[model samples]
Target: MFSKIVIACALVALCQAGFLHYHEAPIHYSAPDHFTPSQSYEAPAIHDEPAHEDHYVDEYAYPKYGYSYSVEDPHTGDHKSQHEERDGDVVKGEYSFLQPDGSFRKVTYTADHHSGFNAVVHNSPPVIHNH
Candidate 1:
């Protein structure tokens, strides 16, 4: 019980310190007294740009991500995998799993501007055991 209490206190202190470290102090600003209306300083004149003038800017951006995961059967020493990704207007995904008879099955998906959408599946032939 004492050790638990000590660990809890240490965790609380660490969390408090982390919060304080990441916190930012607010900024306070004030204009100098010399800029008040009583001073003779004149404000600068402003000019407006003419409209209908063309301004050009170009940008290229895309998002792409992919990750894979696997689950293993601790007793059987077998595993399955899954993955997915998306780039710009295209997306793809897949998953594969092991079968009980020493075979694997895989399924996939794809979509894009031209092909629209499609799904494909493949299966490994079941293992044949001969006596």
Candidate 2:
């Protein structure tokens, strides 16, 4: 039993000595010769300029469509106006208006629909006055 104790003590002492030696060993490391310590960065100088007048631009300088409007009167059953739309090669529109002489004028328009287009306007003859 005494021999076993002595052997264990010797093993513990050897292990401790080896651990200490490894931790105490000096480590060597060196930076490359071409590398230099970075210096503090300095911002570049800027020159101020005088303020200028504000400029404005008109995005909608032109109208999108030629003309568009509508009117309706329930009492007289009088109504007029039209709208036109174009899709691909087809265009169509219709419009009608009541004249001051109690007459009605109607217009129809069509273009590029099945490779054909036409405009027709219907208006009554002007009333002749004997006076």
Candidate 3:
């Protein structure tokens, strides 16, 4: 009628200045509270750790041991030595070497189970290098 009343007064002044609102202007946030888990809350009981007993020691995993070694050399005038011992069924020892024309030998031995073995050898001569 008059441009339909001027388009209804410009849509009522654009809905009173809210410009026909497409929503975005009502924020009042605070966020720092959220642990919601309640139905009269109740949960704290876990026990089962108290039962230990195990021990067995017999004290004899080889009871005894012995060892010895030696060697001497002045440019091929070789010499040697050995020693031994044991604490079960008895066993004693001695040894020596060097014999390739440069003679030298030694041996002293023993055994147990009622002296079932024995040895005693000694020979030494031929190591004269008056150089």
Instruction: Give the number of the best model, judged by TM-score.
Output: 1
Tens-digit lDDT string for candidate 1 (1-131): 99999999999888888433576899999987775456577888998967787778666667788888999887975779999999988999999998888788999999999999898999999878989
Candidate scoring better on TM-score of 1 and 2:
1
TM-score against truth, every candidate: 0.44, 0.34, 0.34
- Candidate 3: tens digits of C-alpha lDDT, residues 1-117: 999999999999888885355878898989888897877966789889888878788876663578999889879767788998977878889898888877778899988899777
Best by lDDT: 1
- Candidate 2 per-residue lDDT, tens place, 25-89, comes to 79899987796879988898887988888989767543233456798997986678987876566
Spell out the clash pairs found in candidate 1.
none
What residue runs in model 2 are displaced by over 4 Å at the alpha carbon?
1-70, 74-78, 113-117, 124-131
Residue-pair clashes per prediction, in order, are: 0, 0, 0
TM-score of 2: 0.34
TM-score of 1: 0.44
- Cα lDDT computed for each candidate against the true fold: 0.87, 0.78, 0.84
